[model samples]
Target: MSLVKAGQLDYLNELFSRYSKRIYNYFLKSTLERAESDDLTQELFIRVMKYRNSYKEGHSVQFWIFQIARNMIKDHFRKMKIHKDQFNLVEVIPEREDVGDDELFEREKKLHRAMKELSDEKRELLVLSKFQGMKYEQIAKMRDTTVSNIKVQVHRTIKELKEAYFQLEEV
Candidate 1:
């Protein structure tokens, strides 16, 4: 039992090291602030460590970690009254280079516009799948849905993104 506990701790540490950057970026995208995202990411790993004993064997670790992140995001939004804070580009916009500022700004504007058009669930799924590189099975487990549902949602989201891109091109 002691050996098992030791192994679990090692695994948890490994998981934290592997996924912290991705988790930080995910939170950064959702919150649009680097400092807040960093704090939340640290809080996430702390929670994982606190609850390590309760993690079931043979379950998907990625899903478990993502579920925790999802809950944290929901709590943050709830506490902050998300609707009151209009999507602010200044929070996430990068510094512009002299040569490509116009092109980059236009592209970022279009991407943000497209992301805003997606439903919250679709946006979250896309972030997890595309940004984090999580598999459909892991996302399904994290979201408490079936893998098939996740696949369908991803397909629809990709189609929507493509449509949005084309619309931007026409503008």
Candidate 2:
């Protein structure tokens, strides 16, 4: 990133190659739209270049990139006037479970449905922590909150997810 920030345009390739797919997956999970995710991913890199001067030295590059991604997602939802309850979290189960394929698929479906029931804020937190594999400390800094607060919120969110999951089972 410093290399890119130093007006060496060629180094942008390294940054793109390193972060593109992970950032793209973040967009995909947040928006749940493949085409939009692609467009957003491309746009994000453009912004990074356009705002390369804003990159602070000695900071985590990953954090800076995700801060941009998070802002873009907020802008997207803002422009669309998207309601919190309307978003759907499509997949929640891991692949390659020891359980039979049919059983795994069923579990995935139920979890997916339960995830959709989460508010957008809760869903985004879960996606960042669980799906994107971002550490709680990173998420805390990203959200401008304390790590303990993020952990408590995550714990409550998990509890909510489990409750929702079991309710689906009873249905």
Candidate 3:
């Protein structure tokens, strides 16, 4: 980031190579839309380059990058809300050779359904803390909250998720 800020644009390639997949997956899991994830991931790096000078010195590059991603995601959801009538909620899961277990597939479907029932804030927290494997501290920092509060929120969200999952399983 510093290098990019210093006018060495070539260094952006290095940063992209390291962070793109993780950023792509983060967007994918958070949005559950492959096409949008691709666009958002591409746009995120562009923003990084465009706003390279805004990065704080000595701060975690990953954190700063994700801050941009988070804002993009929020914007995406806002747009999605405005276009909700045109958006298809149905998703066709792509079969993969690696995922041969029918049980696992069904569980994944139920999990996604359960997640959809959660509030947007709760779902984002769960995705960040659990699916994305982000630490509570980092998430707290990102949300401008305390670590303990984030932990408790994550815990309650998990409990709510479990209840939702079990209910879906029962159905």
Pick by lDDT: 1 or 2, better one: 2
Q: What are the clash counts of all predictions, listed in order? A: 0, 0, 0
**In candidate 3, what are the lDDT values of residues 1-171, reduced to their tens digit?**
788999999999999999998898787767777888889999999999999999999999999999999999999889888887765544424464545788878777788888877876687788888978999999999999999999999999999999999998777
Number of the candidate with higher TM-score, 1 or 3: 3
Off by over 4 Å in 2: 82-106
The list of candidate 1 runs beyond 4 A from truth reads 1-14, 80-83, 86-113
Q: Which RMSD values do the candidates have, in order? A: 4.4, 3.5, 2.1
- The lDDT-based order of candidates, best leading, equals 3, 2, 1
Ranking by TM-score: 3, 2, 1
Q: Which should have the higher lDDT, number 2 or number 3?
A: 3
Per-residue lDDT of model 1, residues 84-117, tens digit only: 4654423444556632669878777677677656
Worst 10 residues of 3 by lDDT: 89-98
Q: Each prediction's TM-score against the native?
A: 0.70, 0.81, 0.87
For candidate 2, what is the TM-score? 0.81
The candidate scoring highest on TM-score is: 3
lDDT of 3 at 165: 95
